[model samples]
Target: MNWMEDGMTSIPNVLLQNYKRLQIEEKEMMVLLHIYSFTQKGISFPSFEDLAERMTISSSDCAACVKKMIQKQVVAIEQGDQTGYEFYSLKPLWNKIAALFESDARGQSLQQAMTAEKDLYSLFEEEFGRPLSAIECETLALWIDQDEHDPSVIKAALREAVMSMKLNFRYIDRILFEWKKQGIKTVDQAREQGRKFRKPTGTEQVTRSENAVPFYNWLEQ
Candidate 1:
């Protein structure tokens, strides 16, 4: 038999990554690994003396650590039906670890969403070429938080305002309102509406001032 194979124990990556989150201290975690190793070698209920021999802790201290694990509901001792013998069970510990991973993923997702929403103000400041006023900032927040407007749609409205050379909060607000009224929920829908609105009628001439770009009169709409 290989010397490496005889000594190896398989520990989960999540156990190492999130042991602190589980409130397990360094010494306590070592005890858990020892317990897992013992279980793997067919020693389910290893005595505290056995655990203490492998670790720096005293047998009494090892017993205390086992008590703590029991209180935390991570490990339990159950009686075997055939032999009437007690052994350690790690089912609860694995369940807790799984729940922690799911909770962390949800927290990260929510944090990312909040970061995107917070960046909306900076985007407006960059386009307007100046810092927004307190009132102007409040209005922008209302559009997202209160009115439930999509950030992409708000950005689309900003682009429309820039093209029209209006460059003001009122014009941008008007564009948003018109899009809402027209049931435009996406950038594609907004672009289609813009094309239709700007299309010239048969009676109108194609000529335009050399200094001006063609844009829809959103205020008139």
Candidate 2:
């Protein structure tokens, strides 16, 4: 065999990537990896003395690390075919790493949603030129949590209201309701609908008089 082939040992990428999430110290991880290497070389249950020989730690410390792993359920002992034999299994470790990664992904998604909700509230307050009342806040929450409206779509509706010179909650609410009725779920869809809604009728120019606001009547639609 080539020298490179003789010396090469491969471990799962997830083991390395998510080892920190395992909540184990670095030394424990080193010990775990060394055990994994031993298993790859066909040694399922290397003696603690043998492990200590490969590392700078004492045999008792190696045993202690293995014990901790066993307590954490990341490693287990299984009986060998021979009555007096046993070995370490790393199955739980891989399972734990995968679960941690999955949980982290969910946590990140939920955090992004929460941040977007806060931003939506702040945007509304800024546009309305005052802090929102409790009922207004609840209405926004209902649109997101109950009606399942996307924050971006709601923000687009707010912009549409501003452009139409109808910067009020009732008009914005009507706009959202109309968009939902039309099955518009995205900001792009809402924009397209807005363009069509504002298309010039015959030779009439789209403009507002001093006492009249030119706006799409979403309430009637």
Leading candidate by TM-score: 2
- Between which residue pairs do clashes occur in model 2? none
Clashing pairs in 1: none
lDDT, candidates in the order shown: 0.85, 0.86
Q: Candidate 1, which ten residues in sequence have the lowest lDDT sum?
A: 212-221
Q: What is the lDDT of residue 160 in candidate 1?
A: 83
lDDT of 1 at 157: 85
Determine the backbone clash count of candidate 2: 0
Query: Which 10 consecutive positions of candidate 2 have the poorest summed lDDT?
Result: 202-211
Tens digits of per-residue lDDT for model 2, 138-202: 99999999989999888888888887789888998999999999999998788789778876664
Deviating ranges (above 4 Å) for candidate 1: 2-7, 41-50, 76-87, 95-107, 177-221
- On the 0 to 100 scale, the lDDT of residue 69 in model 2 is 87
What TM value does model 2 have? 0.76
Could you give candidate 1's per-residue lDDT for residues 1-221 as a string of tens digits? 68876878999998999889889888889999999999999999999999999999999999999899889888899999999999999998999999997998999988986887778778899999899999999989988888778887888888788877898999989988888888988777887897787776554534544335655533232
Model 1 scores a TM of: 0.67
